[model samples]
Target: MLTALNNPRPAMLAVFMLLGGSVAAAASPTITVSWRDKPPYHYLDNGVPKGFLLERTQAIFAAAGIATRLAPEPQKRIWANFSHGATNYCSFSWYRLPEREAVGQYTLPISIDPPHSVLVSGAALARVKTHATLAALLADQELTLGVVDGVSYGPELDAMIAHSANQMMRRTVDTTSMMRMLSVGRASIMLVDREDWEYVHRHEPILQSTTRLDFPDMPPGLKRYIVCSRDISPLVMDKINQAITATGGAVRSSHGTEEERKAHQRP
Candidate 1:
């Protein structure tokens, strides 16, 4: 007859289904994954989210059997969310900074960025080229260095820039705007990410008048990881790390054309 107490399985199943949908739905907790607007990496395209890193992140969560809601937020808001210990919140593709460690737990590397290069205006190229190494160029107090406020040029460069004697002009702007500033000679030079340089160079004619110089003193590319608030569970982080191992972290070709992007997708 399978009375209520004798056979609680059916009742439990019904309650589970009623509460959520199925066992899977109840077991899988959904988290909000946030990212800043850094195109060809992670950004909004005409209101729809797009980016190789975003796609790769989606794939990692799916492979880990986790549920995620993609959220595009400003850089400041993203950090603020982590600082306040927002439950089940995560941000993608950030450098594993020492100061940031206090706010969030980092998963295994999610992406790797190529080393930074110097973007010099035509008026500054000759002076910039005179220096044999990045150190020498940064030490030049005569040159004004344009930096994006609150951004890291990776650990090595960040340290160098902090101690550099050069004149500084810092702004809170995107790479495109920074490139424009360089074109107008607002600053003599700026450190640029290789991927950002490629994307901006193709779209901005101003780059044609500028130069991208790589230096021997430049550090190797930096590895980026998915950082989550303290409230996110260890189980979830383990799954993410396993997924990162299964799929070689998300560094894909950043130079794909729009047609190619439309044709290709990760399986």
Candidate 2:
């Protein structure tokens, strides 16, 4: 009788251990992500978050068995929160820089290339016959350039822009307002991502009259990434990268249609 009772106790103990292990494995961590209003890439549609990067990130996290909740906030505030480590938030389609690298860690390449071009009004395009580079475009003494505030143009190019001493304007507001300013002749040229310009043109007909200035080459060393706080576990970064690799290196755009790509490339 004593032997039989001891045998049952051991079996019961093993069952309890197995159940505890299952519970521990099932407790997947949930993380909060921050995003700004960048259309076709990240934005809110009808009060629900939607965009290519947002969707892809969600899919990757889900596949990795990591649950996530997205919180849409202003660009500046989101970065601030992430920087202070007050929030466990990640930002997508971010460019990697040394200064930023110090405070943040990035996943493997999310987008291999970033579309870059000089956007100008139709009237301005007619006046300016040619520009092969951003420097060449800035050579025009009378030309006023607009850039998004808080955006870094990489180290070398950023230094050039800062030293140029040219008449440059910046806005902390949305891209739509920048387009409006250009259309109204408030600025001669606006430096922007080609994808962003196309996104606005397709969705907002108000920018239909704008033209893309042909440059010899795109601004160099531009790539997008999934940025996370430096404090995040290295294991988490590895998991995210694994998920991204499994889905292919590039995140498919929600608005990346064959027709759109072809149309944007047209002369």
Candidate 3:
């Protein structure tokens, strides 16, 4: 099934009876909440949707007293819908990108990822260890970098990749395929989010012949947001932002600078 229904009746009743403000009407058009099949973040378990981000998104909508329909969609399809200005649609956990800003409206960050790590094949591990920074490794023309098509490694790394002269192996595949490619030495190295690396490392055996490496020049963790199409009202966005704040979601401060965010994040 492409869509899963969320029963908002009980929550709606509670909102009307106890929370008692002019929350969105229960009869409002149902917003479609779309997600890709990225496990530990969002995926279907026995036809029932489950994941940290999925649950948080449901909670936010429930708190906002808006009706929503959960839908599992391909990553490319989700972005394509936004580009075409699909109405009443929202997707969770996307990095804020410049080009994407023109297509969709973004809510406050709903989650954050740890810094990206490089997955190096056993054959390339020795060579990978020679580079002190990510820039040097990307400068190596002989080392082929495997990248997932249509995915961004955040603004900083995306900029690096665009300017690098390294041989690139772009695949329209998932992380598992990329990992398998590395294990078989088809690609020398690939960058993966630390969260994704941990999840795949536990559930898949492809990492047996690959090693995860970190570099000092790796960009700071990227903040993920719930992006909705243009038709979603500003009023609704304010409600969503309020719900995010209530659920302990983090937002960039007025200055909106990474340096300030990093300083505040320091332990």
**Maximum-TM-score candidate:** 1
> What clash count goes with each model?
0, 0, 0
What TM-score does prediction 2 earn? 0.82
TM-score between model 3 and native: 0.84
lDDT of 2 at 52: 71
Q: Pick the winner on lDDT between candidates 1 and 3.
A: 1
What's model 2's lDDT at 95?
75
Which residue pairs show backbone clashes in model 2?
Answer: none
Model 1 stretches astray by more than 4 angstroms: 1-25, 250-267
Best first by lDDT, ranked: 1, 3, 2
Cα-based TM-score, every candidate: 0.84, 0.82, 0.84
Of 2 and 3, which scores higher on lDDT?
Answer: 3
Query: lDDT score, residue 262, model 1?
Result: 38
Sliding window of 10 residues with minimal summed lDDT for model 3: 252-261
Tens-place lDDT digits, model 3, residues 243-265: 99898886321222556335322
Clashing pairs in 3: none
Count of clashing pairs, candidate 1? 0
Quick one: best lDDT, which candidate?
Answer: 1
